[model samples]
Target: MPVELKTPPSDDWVPSMDDLPFHRLGGEEEVKALANAFYDAMDADEPALARLHELDAQGRVNAGTRERFGLFLIGWLGGPQHYMERHGHPRLRMRHGHLPVDTGMRDAWLRCMRKALDARGISGGLRRFLDERFANVADFLRNTEG
Candidate 1:
């Protein structure tokens, strides 16, 4: 005789992994760590981050850049919308409009992001998704020669 398979009970179907909640509160810690890693990579990889460092030196991304980037990442990583709450809409492209973000710059940014993500020990799927999303955002931020 074949046994019948029983269906599991269905509840409200709450999502198991709530990305937003995960990034809120202490979630900002990861963002801060990622920012640190990104900066570290920029400092270490001379050629990759040369242009970015130049821009930073020009005061385009002064000291406040770290704090702002941390806050922004907090929100971007599905944490509390602190960046949006404090700065209103991100207006990413507009904010970066003055910067000369070329293909090389974009690649450098992605490289730093990749290193940071790798350092985070995030799940493979999440890492892949984030990398792709970051690439798209980085590409959108690019406003210079190809």
Candidate 2:
């Protein structure tokens, strides 16, 4: 089962478009576009993303996976917190522990993230911030020495 991120129960909690920096900067469509770009990078790049493709081939990441990923990103980018609302703390390392992620994997993830950010046409500041955040999470997701 996929891990879920949890959030405090608050009936007053209503996600607004302005809640997410990405949305405030771009929009909902832009966010989706960014996600699509990221997925495209993961799909197109072989040398750095072969593992991801293999995972997809193994049925580990399907359409649902993409949707979850996009939802996670939406929340992660300070948006609606939909992921946490529906799912729970994103224990990313623990969840990805089963994957054979290493330095190579981390780099590949970063590369795809960079490509995605570029595709969004976001500001340099946001891109840098995202790069740092992605690096930290990707590093934590690494479960191997190779």
Q: Deviation in angstroms for 6 in model 1?
A: 21
Q: Write the per-residue lDDT of candidate 2 for residues 52-146, one digit (tens) a residue.
A: 44345553335565666777877777777777877786788777777788897788888887887777665445555566778998887878998
Best by TM-score: 1
Per-residue lDDT for 99 in model 1? 82
What is the TM-score of candidate 2?
A: 0.71
List runs of model 1 lying over 4 Å from the truth.
Answer: 1-17, 20-26, 46-63
lDDT of 1 at 95: 85
Q: How badly does each model clash, as a count of residue pairs?
A: 0, 4
Highest lDDT model number = 1
